[model samples]
Target: MADGSDPEYVAYVHGRAAALRRTAYLLCGDTHQADDLVQETITKLYARWPRIGRVDNLDAYVHSILVRAFLDEKRRGWWKVRLGVPPERPAPPHPGVEERAMLRAALTRVPPRQQAVLVLRFLCDQPVADVARALGCSEGTVKSQTAHGLAALRRILGNPLEIGMAR
Candidate 1:
């Protein structure tokens, strides 16, 4: 058995780890980077477990930590370093997979703050108020970011129809 194991903390981590990983993956679009983000977030959570335990919304607190960590990583110059060239590969054959790939590629083109806003609003189904609180911005900012991010995505994708925008 692990020394000084806190059952509550262990259970919380177990239940939320997958969700955290998925959010991280959407933010970074790389499984390895997502894993790193989750690991870092969990470590920070563990260190502040006592304070975090007292929070009314644990999920939101953890998400805030995760998002901030991702933003911080992006701000660091070392995070942009690529070690090797990529090999060429054929496109996905399935339409669904291809569409998802295209969407993700377009998402990567968005600024980090806009990407975070879009992910939190659409992917996580968070309300504008919640997103504002998480990003430490006003609700108006979240709404504007969502609009700008969608516009940027449409431009990058070059097919607004494909994004299913309402007329």
Candidate 2:
């Protein structure tokens, strides 16, 4: 039998790479770090493609890999030292630049793990079970983290309901 390297693996990487990068960005809140994390995860997956390809839910499997990589990277010393620095806030969609900046600052203050949970659970709109699967934690952990993250966000930014109509 041949080793795992193959054209189909290359095609799969090309197809999923951008989406994986975006998911990684949402997970880590840093574009550069996100790119690195996606690359690392894809490299590992590529090396084990024979096994990985056999999984029924390969997309979910890859997502789990990305999330684990982001968490692992943060556990290392670099993210710890750089934690205080805010993510590069994108330009506001319209007026109220100050408000956007304030929100970004508040989100930056959130714990990285909390931010990750919120992004995956709320922003990405993943269900608790799926989020738990991605985070490699129990569903209870996802639920608790989501609750705490929302509470902290509300405490920092004031009532989301008061801000405006629910989007």
What's each prediction's TM-score?
A: 0.80, 0.75
- Candidate 2 differs from the real structure by a C-alpha RMSD in angstroms, to one decimal, of 4.2
- The lDDT per prediction is 0.80, 0.75
Tens digits of per-residue lDDT, candidate 1, 41-144, equal: 99998888766546777888888899989878876443233326452235878666766766776676678788889988888788998888888899999999
Model 1 residue 78 lDDT?
31
Candidate 2 residue-wise lDDT, 1-167, digit = tens: 22345777788789899889888877766789889999999888877787764677777888888888877766534324426665555776875775746655566556666777888886677888888888888999988898888788788787743542346
> Evaluated with TM-score, which candidate comes out highest?
1
Candidate 2 residue-pair clash tally: 0
Provide the RMSD of all predictions against the true structure, rounded to 1 decimal: 4.6, 4.2
